[model samples]
Target: MIPSSRNWQIKVAIAVLTLPVVFSPVSEAQVSQTLKAKESEAKQFMGLMNKAQQVYYAEKAGFTSSVSNLLVNVGFQNKPDTANYSYSIGMVNKAAVFNYGVSKQANLKSFVGGVFLVGNDTQTILCLNAAPGKIKPPNPTNTKGVLKCAAGTEKIAQYNYF
Candidate 1:
């Protein structure tokens, strides 16, 4: 009876140890499936993000282009002496240009435009007499205006006006 009891205990131990080994392949398969699912979800999320980013930059570029075109039609020129007009448009255009630059570097869709800045002590509406698509090219085009840069000459930075 003692020998038989010892044999039974050994059998129980063997069974206990083998149980996990028997189920390990199934557990591994489940883990692999979970990893694959997560990878697929991440890919989908990245796709959506890319799409959103493209749309956002496209809209921003369009808006900036429209504003610049409007300003050109209304004769909004940059002042060489002062820094007001370029500063304002440059600030706004910088954000848009940065986004566009990132999108372009990421191999995403983007648009381009020209930014012009003009300042007057009192707001004045100047008109462009040129026909559509015949507008003058964007340059310093100060139109004899005063530009006020807070940091003076140290803040002359290159901007993506187009």
Candidate 2:
């Protein structure tokens, strides 16, 4: 009876140790599938942007205005002080550019900024916004600059390619 009990304990330990190795492949496959789904979702948004003129315009304006404000707040103070600064915001070729002319000239850390989404639903208007052109936000995976969004939110779609 004592010998049988010892043998049972040993068998249980071996099974526990082997279980992870046996199931690891299955988990890996699931992860791959999840990633593919996310990629497909992103592609769908990109396609929408490419075809829908109004949405593209809105996204471009939103990105431009957001970036302009960020630049001004981050020590780029040379503007109208009281009056609002206006810039011609538009998408040039494939990239969104906010042409401010020479109204407020300060040495910017970088001229170009990257746009990214910041919401659970990629289809949501609240999703697309640019990160600050100067400061890289902590935990960029979850937030863009000072903005925070839900986890599993998609980053910027591939509209930049167009």
Candidate 3:
């Protein structure tokens, strides 16, 4: 009688623990929220990079060629976690080019993004060839833009999905 009661209690405990996983909308919503969070981070990181570039270009004629230098100058010991993207900056076409996206450890299968921000204080915008985010391209020819880091028909969708 004691063994049977113990087995029954164990089964009850298991069912109680598994009930949420078996029938819960919370997990699905959480996944969607996480994806949205990553996208938000990407946008915030772009703004941060733009600020850093502003400071760098003000002192120098051109943009910094290194991401580490820019981060250090901007007073970050490491990339902030508020964003889910890693950043790399360089000089392209005489423009400060900032690229930030998910790292390999963040996505195992594939990471489909590289948002290119090119411009100085006088002129800059997310490149036309870059992900437009449903907004029309400012420059279809992309010649008026001083910098570009994308090619072909690639488009960065919401959540940075291809």
Candidate 4:
């Protein structure tokens, strides 16, 4: 009788521990909301990076690949990388470049932002991967003002200023 009672208690404990993993609409919705919140944070951070790059470019006549440079020279106050994402910047072209935020968490959206020098004006675009997978930053065209996202990605925002 004691052995049977102990086995029952162990089984109940296991079931309770696994309850969160069980398939349920409420859990699914909660996960979706959490993912969306993470994506929003990523986008907002990328946007801030974009603006800092723009300012750095104006003052230095070019963009810096170093986040510390942006922080010191452009007065960018936020951390370069976040808990959910790691960031990198590269010059895709002489007059166009991109910043990439790679997702560290599974199922989280990664982001990319492009800055293009179009004549006397600057055009910026932000894009995100259509699916949660390896994200590659788009190589923007230097000849045109527009920045086109690669396959499996979609544009989410754009900024144009003189």
Candidate 5:
């Protein structure tokens, strides 16, 4: 009832071919690429929240600290948090600061989005942390009307979305 030598050889070859797929760990490059994708997603999420805040402010005449308010008032669809990041918003010295911090992955970068007034026009800014850790957006300066990120972060984009 035993299989022939040729059949056994073919089965062994097939098993060997599938072994790497089954037991191989993800490579460093692959991990890096995945972390990069998550980082991009975090950034995009911040952008979307910034836009939503713009719309909400236009209708409400003020900014909201709650993402639920953005969803209900502005009709923007998003989860407050994701598997890789957690989102938050609050009034930081008269500015609406949106923050996204790493939730599960250490390699993913954190982000902050700020909505504030600049010379009678509303401005939005997106900033990225220098490295992955718990970072918060700094309060905007009253005299300069600028939203500066904390020392370890850098501003990546700014917009005036009306």
Candidate 6:
């Protein structure tokens, strides 16, 4: 026996409603993976900057604020902007720092100063971006882990990004 037309319509409606439920988790996972990739890229950039600063310091006894100097002179010529991130290795108050700007403007609210790492003579300091447009606990604080930030900044402890 065949089902009535009314019954078939009810089944179709149920299937349509359930489609989103099945796909929602997949969408969320995709986004999470993408963010993870972006974070990895950011950390890689930080490392490259560290090497470049070392070279510059070895030659000049201090750091340069120009990203161009890091890329052209030291030969770390990777793309400055990734698919989901843009960044600059520069000076804040004559101190060397690495700043990251995300493609998602909404995320900017959570990533104030777009800076994740700062550096000095012996160690690296992870700047805490707790507030919008400002990094809290000040520089040289031992909150986040250590990252080898470029020269011209403050540092004291070792921390890991992953």
Prediction 4 global C-alpha lDDT: 0.78
The order by descending TM-score is 4, 5, 6, 3, 2, 1
Query: What TM-score does each of the candidates earn?
Result: 0.35, 0.35, 0.52, 0.79, 0.73, 0.61
lDDT ranking, best first: 4, 5, 6, 3, 2, 1
The best candidate by TM-score is 4
Q: What's the CA RMSD for each of the models?
A: 20.6, 16.6, 8.3, 3.9, 4.9, 6.9
What is candidate 3's lDDT per residue for 1-162, written digit by digit as tens? 356988999999999999998868888788767766665566556556656666666666556757677778889787543334444553445543444433323321112222222343433333322332322222212344433334432333322111
Give the alpha carbon lDDT tens digit for every residue of 74-158 in model 6. 7666567655455555455433444333344333211212223334342334332333332222333223434432333333224
Query: Which one wins by lDDT: 3 or 5?
Result: 5
Error of 6 at 44 (Å): 1.6
lDDT of 1 by residue, 1-162 (tens): 356888999999999999999999999899777644543333333232223323434444322333233334435553311211111122244222111111111211111122223331111111111111212212222234432222111112223211
lDDT tens digits, residues 1-162, model 5? 999999999999999999887766666568778878888888887888888888877877777888777766766665668787888777765545554444356666678777886665678878787887645545333347665665667888888878
Query: What residue runs in model 1 are displaced by over 4 Å at the alpha carbon?
Result: 1-5, 62-162
Clashes of each: 7, 0, 0, 0, 0, 6
Please write out the lDDT profile of model 2 over residues 96-145, one tens digit for every residue.
22222111212111111123333321222212222212221121122332
Off by over 4 Å in 5: 1-26, 134-143
Single out the weakest 10-residue window by summed lDDT for candidate 6.
108-117
How many backbone clashes can be found in candidate 6? 6
Report how far off residue 112 is in candidate 1 (Å): 25
TM-score of 2: 0.35
Best by lDDT: 4
* Local lDDT at 30 for model 2: 88
lDDT of 4 by residue, 3-59 (tens): 698899999999988886785778899989999998898898888777877887787
Residue ranges of candidate 4 with Cα displaced over 4 Å:
1-23, 140-143
Regions more than 4 Å wrong, model 6 = 1-4, 92-104, 108-120, 127-162
Better of 1 and 4 by TM-score: 4
State the displacement of the C-alpha of residue 20, model 2, in Å, after optimal TM-score superposition.
1.3
Global lDDT of each candidate: 0.31, 0.34, 0.47, 0.78, 0.72, 0.48
